[model samples]
Target: MSFLVMDDGEYSFIWETLCDLQLIFHPKYSREGKIDHKELLGLNIKKVSVMLDRNLLSSLLKLTRDGYLKDEQEMRIIALLMTWMIMNNYPASAGLALKEYATKINDLIEPKRELREFNNIFDYYPSMMWLRLAEGAIDSIPVCPLPTEPFITEIKYNEDDDHLLMHIAEMLHVVYLCRRRELSPVEKMLDFLIWNYKYLLICESTLVYTAMLFTSQSGIKAPKNSGSNDIGKILVGCRNQAWDLNYLSNWSSFHYYEKTMDEIFMFATNDILLKRIFINTYTSGGVGALIEAVFSKSDSQKIFEVVNFNQRNRIKPDFGADPKIYLHQLIEQEKHRVMETISDRGNFNYH
Candidate 1:
């Protein structure tokens, strides 16, 4: 078979591979739209290390001093992963620094484990994903596969990317909540906080962390004026860091971050997914007395399923006398379907 030609399966795998690879590419990002703020990618290890989270730098510093680590291999692996995540999520001044760092760190560490020639995903995952994405693209090149390209109206990928920015902003709100609390047994709840430091970087290998008060007592501040618009900062971070669409970077002579940030702020404040059900539950009375309805003798609780963000998606069964039946009725099949559908509605691409 010619190397240039690809099968259907091969085409499918390419997109999946790109998704996987893109997960770890750390993009250089900032709130600024100046020349320096303009994004770049494929950074070198040194520059990545410079921009790394302080805690990550500290860990590496100690590792250098101690000259040993409990699981050197795992530690090195995490560092490599961060390099990619950084490239994918943030802007890089250099190209493919993460891959280079992984190789270098792997060689430098004890029990020197060279990346296997052709087996583990970690070894050649980035290259494989890139290849697949290329095969799937119309041009069969490694450039962005975003549809709705130039000389037209706004793009679908543009909206999707914007929506994702909002999602990340909401997720950051939870992270802030976690940071506010005192350090306890971690992951005791949904937020996963319990940190002593303001912004504690805990996860080994990866530098993902949270800050108690990175800005002020109120919380994260931003260039924007609105209170709800604080999430603008988070979106700003992602925009600056994300691949291709650098926030300040001049992509095709267009610096879109300023416009994108405003759009992101609107989405974050509106919270489309939350509002969809809120409108129905509070005003329409659609979420009527759940338990009472389910328990009612006439209600068919057996067939109904509850569709709640926190609740598991499953059928709730109850006999005529069962008290929980009414609650189950509250989550009727129709409600479940609507809620499920609306839950994912914010994912719509307005592009």
Candidate 2:
């Protein structure tokens, strides 16, 4: 089936419709934002089409119509917009527009995939894309041998190549939260601490032990049948070597970590599936709450002490000396002291 190029009017209508729908469904504007639907419908589209990316959009649509791209690829391209909506915390009102847009777009190429399948693709595509990209990153590392002269020349001369590389890096950054979500609760908390507190010399066993102690004191039931020793051993085996702090200290970094955490907390609290998992797993208000509860100021101080003490008195792991035991003892002593204080308060009479 031949598909004609979308006219300027058509392009403007699509662009304006998307923009209005996005505003209508955006978190800050959803309640108060209003659009004159009839007025918008009656407006001249040609005037507004001048600023839109007409060539790029038309090329993409043309590619789909001409069967240069597979059905799934076309769906994924459409789903990228929905993925953007999800990532930006857009409200559900915008999803209806997105789904309808997807349907209409698919119809242009004689839809082979069902609407339900489209919905499913949209729902999980971000996570799947993240997983695939992560795997690709891992596999593609230790960059294959290339014709170095041409590679250097291409990088030096091609502006488009720079743009492509920057785009890939941005994709990796955007999907980071999805990668973190794949981790277990303890691992997630550990990752959070390591990321936010780079000064802390964290190890897997220390984190696992801390989590266990935190769970014990917080009265939160730990995951059934998952022992600290086993988890710690598994994690420690996979741990990377310590970072070169000197280099990291010199580099300027963005404050995106907190924003990422906020997004995770929002998703955990708002999304039904994520909410269920968050509730069942952490039994806390949200990601930040869980991290704060698990790694309190006192806990942080104690961890530093234990870690530093262990570092000073380094013992080979093969020798039956486990630093986690020291951490466990410290937490138990603190718990005992707290209980004694509670008992003392209980016996005191109030005026």
Give the best candidate by TM-score: 2
Taking all chains together, each candidate's TM-score versus the true structure is 0.20, 0.20
lDDT (Cα, 0-100) at 108 in candidate 1: 30
lDDT of every predicted structure (CA atoms)? 0.27, 0.29
* Worst 10-residue lDDT window, candidate 1: 262-271
- Candidate 1 residue lDDT tens string, 1-351: 112334667544433443333221222231111111123333323222222221233333333334334554423433333333333343222212222233223323211111121112222234333333333332122222222222221222222232223223333433334333353312212232222111221221111111112212132222121122233343343322222111111221122253333211100001222222222222222333322232333331321232132134223333247433432343232233323332354432211
User: What does the lDDT read for residue 166 in candidate 1?
Assistant: 25
Q: Candidate 2: where is the Cα deviation over 4 Å?
A: 1-9, 16-67, 72-192, 199-351
Q: Tell me the lDDT of candidate 2.
A: 0.29
**Which pairs, if any, clash in model 2?**
none
| CA shift of 208, model 2, Å | 20
Error of 1 at 64 (Å): 38
Error of 1 at 287 (Å): 30
Candidate 2 lDDT by residue in tens digits, 1-351: 112233455435434543443322111112112323344334333111111111223323433334233444333333333333343333222212222233335332222222222233334333334222222321111211212121111111211122222222222221231233355544444443443233223333223323543344443222222222232221222111011111111110111242333221111011122222223233323333433555667654554555466567654332126444443443344334323433444542211
